[model samples]
Target: MRARDVRAILFCAVTTLILLIGSYVLLQSALISLALAAGWLAWLLTRPRMQRVIRRLRGEPDWNGYFRND
Candidate 1:
């Protein structure tokens, strides 16, 4: 895996952990934690860099013929 992909995964993991702690330990709610985590994941998925990492992890080729216009 590329450094960027590793970094992205780490970032996601850390952010989710913090959010979970804040939601349950601090705020005392599991529902809010779930919503916040889902929101964060949705936002992350919208990022182009994250999308590239996800595609790479899925073993998709970077230079597929679908990218070219006929």
Candidate 2:
């Protein structure tokens, strides 16, 4: 894989591992896990490049469906 792809994969793997460890240390509280997951998702969503990639992979017509095209 390309360096960028490898880096992205490493980042995602590390983040997932960290979240899993955090959840375990928190005694498997659903609320805490859900909150962490939601926050991570929100952070990803706010990144312009990630949103564009998601829309592209999902075959979305535009990044902002109700507004202007990306």
Tens-place lDDT per residue, model 2, 11-41, is 7667866886788687678777768877876
Let me know the TM-score candidate 1 reaches against the reference structure: 0.79
- Candidate that scores best on TM-score: 1
Worst 10-residue lDDT window for candidate 1 reads 61-70
Identify the runs in model 1 with alpha carbons over 4 angstroms from their true place: 64-70
Score residue 40 of candidate 2 by CA lDDT.
79
User: How many clashes does each candidate structure show, in the order listed?
Assistant: 0, 0
RMSD of 2: 6.5
Off by over 4 Å in 2: 1-14, 26-28, 60-70
